[model samples]
Target: MHRLLLPIDALVTLFVLTAVWLGVSSSYDPALSYPVQLGVIVSGGVYLAVAHGLVTWRIAYVFGRLLLLASTAAAAVFILQFAYQDYVEVPAIIERIGSLTTLLPNLNLAWQHPNAEAAFMIGTIPLGVVLIVTSRRWLWRSLWIVCTLVCLYALLLTFSRGAMVGLGATLCIAGLVLSKKLIVRVGAVALLIGGIAAVALTSAGSAWVLSRWDLYRNSLYVAGDYVLTGIGLGDTFPLVYSRYGLLIQVPQLTYPHNLLLSVWMGQGLPGLVIFLLLIITFYLFVRRVLRSQPRRLFHAGWLGVTAILIHGLFDSRQYIEVLWLMGHLFALIGLTAACGRLALWQPEEDVPKVFRRYFPNRLVAATAIAAVIAVILFNQELLAAWHTNQGALAETHAELNPTLRAADREAGFRQAQSLYQQALAINPVWPNANRRMGNLYVKAEDFAQAVPLLEQAYRAEPANIATIKGLALAYMWNGQLEGAAEGFNLLPDPARMAEELLTWGYWRTNEQDQPLLGAYAYETSQLMLPGNVSIPVWQAAADAYRAAGELERARQWYERILAEAPDNTAARQALAELDDA
Candidate 1:
């Protein structure tokens, strides 16, 4: 047990340390949020603690039984949820045409995304297999089979192409290895073929498969630039990919979808090596158990690991805590098989002399106390920021809701302001809190207060689109044209910037500020939307030029608009008016 644990502990520690190092080295302060960093550290600690507890108790059999039971219950819940969504929520969107495959929205199931849930379910399938194979009674085997089938059904409903492919591979391997009869192997092949056909025939499924190929290609483009160190954690992908990815719409991909690539991207080469080492070690352990026992549980573990590895090639699952726990659970069971029964408890006196002398219980207690303090220090600010954002959202709802009474709307605004103040009081440096508060002020047309708050937020997360947009609008409203232009120029999407600029120009025109309005329209003219040459844009440009006494430029734009739409009455009238001028 100690031998097995030593390697696992070393690997986990290395992974966690690498993650922390990546975070520290990141150029973007919010590249890895506090919650994610803390979660990773805590997950490693929890894994170690759980493994230690399991080994010390010597209840591997009991634990295995309990795990099977829990997995079965979870599978049941997943199936129920999937069924409800498919039958109940699905019909409401029947009129919408695209892919019938997408009619059932992917089940997130407590995870951040459906892919994560699929990973969890796919990882659990092997445990069910193990239980089924090991069961003595027919009833137990039948029940395990039912549970596994339910889990598989839910996995299918997730519409996760990676999981489906992984499932096919797993089934093939399991059939070849576990089945003595040729009929069983044939049955497995038939299932695989059927699964492939089902996915391929579905409208969305084919598109999903093609998209993954494209994603991989784009990911490679990003990998080329950051080949060695890779982009540091958090949401740097948006920034990096915008600069280096394929010339498509800047995708909102937060992470490299592939598990190995994600590790490489976040932690660089050393981290990737450590991750591969961990996988290799676990594989070897599972192999050893299979060689010795050749039982249902070992085979199931092997297949489960294989399925996750295959799925991970297409999507990220390695970072998810539940999957990590499952992996650790399998490793512990393997260790129990490798090392027979041993002493369940070890006394303090029996502990190594060096450990006792240097790392005593007092030191351990102090470390635990410091950890608690650190977590409190870290999470309080984040929680406060969340509350502040929630308040801002409530204020937005109040403003948008026409049914709300004037008094109620005023109260909502006050509550939002109080929340923002509370958030700032808790943590002045909390990103988004000040930005959101500034946005609230902008909504209220209080440019004076919005400016400084927005400036502060922009300083914290300069590349954040929301911050840039809010700050730009705030600057414009405050009559700071240069600052507004600077902020607007920083926007990556030319189309969006042009639209916003045109909107601002109309607002300025209403305010009788022709010069600023003209400047906005001129800026809009300089911006180009990909694959689109809009006549309305040209008309705005012509109107601005005419207002600014640039008659020749105005005539050219009017001509251009007329060329695009020969029957455009407004353009013809504008052109005639320009001719007279």
Candidate 2:
């Protein structure tokens, strides 16, 4: 590894850890993403460590080069499959494999989108194409030409309007840099003109232009909201985008379709700053090293980095909160640095060794060891959360069991009990741990055992919506309405508690042929429904008030319903019955 590696790795690792910490510390009271994020970050950190340990730059370079080459092969296969699907018979093997792919134009998959895929290819394809010119050996040069030609054939099919425009821009720049020849330059200019005119008049072009505008606008909104601290990692951006990004209405969106904006929204300003710093470091390191490295792989590594940067403008996959997906980019950086070291050191004569002299760097060594220790020792919240999740999953399985098999259900319950115990052991007073265990006890109809756990949960997180609602409901079901009252008193907005109680009430009234809890929820909601609420909701709310013997309250609700919905015969009949009373 290069001497500069420590800082590069440090920044990237810090950014990653920061992202995990954000998830751990997110407002998710149960810290829903905490355990998963911790696992991802730790595992990703391990991969990066191991990936960098491909200490022989030559070895790492070969590994990365093969993967990049494989992408070309993948594209070619996909293009062939597309052609076959269009016309006649495809080989069963190819036909079956093609079924997994979703993007239809035959492309590299950036979120299974051809435009995005084309953008990424536009970035990396240059590196692959450059190999033909740089390779001294005819055998290697021949391979490069074949791959590049296949890649271009696929790229042409894969591209949409915006990608077409981007490709034209890239060709123009490449032509200027690669040759001073007038013919090539003029051709590049002509291609740019044709490329721009080729797609702009089409409906697809106009649609994308509008879609991208809205996406960009919404993305900017998300970025602006969390400008300083960022949106905080995990499945955060999607939610933040939905709420803050009011500009576009989307079914589901992972990113803003722009890379720099993605970093800003996910990590906030500090993350973006650190990311930029890492890029700057890569640029400076490459500048110093590129002149000395005549090796094809070394240059390819630079081009690979270039591919991501340029493609990133249109769409991003590697910068997502999912660490494994994001970590590959960092691995590439390490490989690039390693390639530089190998090139400058006369690597042909040097004996290749994995992690050669690695442990000598105490910082890296300690980081590796300390990471493990810290996760186990310090992250009590994550540890507890993992156990709690296992318990929840077990409970879900028990509930989902269709056979009503006692042994299976009992076994699942026992498994959940043990997992919850482990979670409580990890953190004695962790609110979610206590609360979930209490919920399990409630499920078993052991309110006596549930009370303390629910109390502990309420005490630990006085304002947690889930904890409050869960605890209050447990109290109501346990026939200790005072306990419910106490928990509910803490929350200024008791609507969730009321809502949960009503949900339970529905099950009791309709399913269990019991009305007590249902009546309680209805009274708690004060027979209140917005005027615009559906008739079904009003009927449910009315049922509870009637069950509670609040006939006048029920009558008032019926009158309110009949006022707006005069044609509702059910409301009129109910009102007539109430008038007789």
Candidate 3:
């Protein structure tokens, strides 16, 4: 049991350290809340603990066999769903092509992302390979073969282009490692080349492949810019990409897509080095174990890890379920290798007498007690913040329902407000609680109450667009025209400014502020809605200028509208009225 726990201890220590560093250094992304991060940590801990227990109790072999059976059954279900969707639900080839434009349908498998499902299936390929190689019975071999084929088919259905590349590369490498004959190696190479060619030659495949290439090139540029201290963990790629990714016309992305680059960009050079070192150490240990033990299961797990790592080269999977699964497999392999080692008791005689005299059990006990107390103190605030976020999400869902009854909607808002207050009572400056509460008030059209809450949120996350928009609107509705305009000016894009102006334009009651708002709106419109302004937008702009007694500017806009639509009665009347003025 001690030998089994050794590898897990090392792994847990490393993971805990990494998690701690990330939590401390990561830039706070509202999308990646503290509750989510805490949940991931808890889940990973549970997985590791369970995996360690299975290995220590010598039940890992049975567990692995059962897992393979379950996975194969799931793969069959996935394949049937795919076939049903493709053949019966939407048979047309053109419709399938259209579906690929969005997300590739998951066939009702609970894995939300197709790429994640594909990665899991691809990782299973090595297990099938190991079973086929090790099983002496014909029935077992045939079952493994069927499982492998099904997984391969399911992988293709996922349409995860990067996973496809990784799978091909992994299979080719496995073939070379497992096959001793030169002829077999040659066949493996040929199959790899042929498969890649087949995929790349297809029109959709070509587009997918080329787009990744563009993204990869852009990622290199990002890596170069932050080659030293990185942008910090959990920092959205858009934070840097907005400035650097324009050349590639890269859409808004959450991550770098490449696992290694993601680490480099998030945690800096030191963190990247540490991550690579961990991988290298694990690989070396696996290789050493395989040499001594020559176990088929160990070989399979090593191959699976290799495949996932290859996949990670082209896609980010570090924070997902794949990583946890990989960690479990690594622990099992490590435990198998360490099983021959003697327990720590056997080494006690070799310890120095002076060191042996001082037992650290008391110190350990005191440390444990302190840690428990700290956690108990911290958990109260964390729970409050988590509940507050949940309430906010509930409110958002209620607000989204256009057909919701007034009573139910009000109840949701009230519940959300209560939750936010609870969170504030625990931690007054809790990150998003104030902002969410403020937005709730804004939705209710209670601008006076919203202004102070929004101001607090704005102070907390000054760069957040939602906070800026909410505060600006709150100010506008509360009759603070100058403050609203100032908040609108904080936006980076002219188009966004124009759009927001249109949203809150009706609130401009101040005569003094009308000409300023009108002039800014019209100027931004020229850049945004070139060639022809929509009638409503033009009329709104004309009305603002007219309210400000700026007939000349209003007349010019009216003339422009008339140019687009010569028969426009409103524009003609407005121009005539301006002329009379």
Query: Which model scores highest in lDDT?
Result: 1
lDDT of 1 by residue, 398-473 (tens): 5544477899889888887888888788877665578767877887779899999989988877866667777877
Q: How does model 2 fare in lDDT?
A: 0.60
**How high is the lDDT of residue 62 in model 1?**
54
- Model 3 scores worst on lDDT over the 10 consecutive residues at 336-345
Distance from true position, residue 392, model 2, in Å? 28
lDDT tens readout by residue for model 3, 5-99 = 34434554454455455532443243432433344356445545543555332354455555566667656665554533443322265346434
When summed lDDT is taken over every stretch of 10 residues in candidate 2, the lowest stretch is 351-360
Q: Against the hidden reference, what TM-scores do the models get?
A: 0.57, 0.48, 0.56
Among all windows of 10 consecutive residues in model 1, the one with the lowest summed lDDT is: 337-346
Model 2, 516: alpha-carbon shift in Å?
Answer: 30
Top model number, TM-score:
1
Question: lDDT of each structure?
Answer: 0.62, 0.60, 0.60
Q: Model 2, stretches more than 4 Å misplaced?
A: 4-7, 27-61, 73-124, 134-146, 149-171, 178-203, 247-252, 290-293, 319-325, 342-581
| Residue pairs in candidate 2 whose N, alpha carbon or C atoms collide under 3 angstroms | 123-307, 230-268
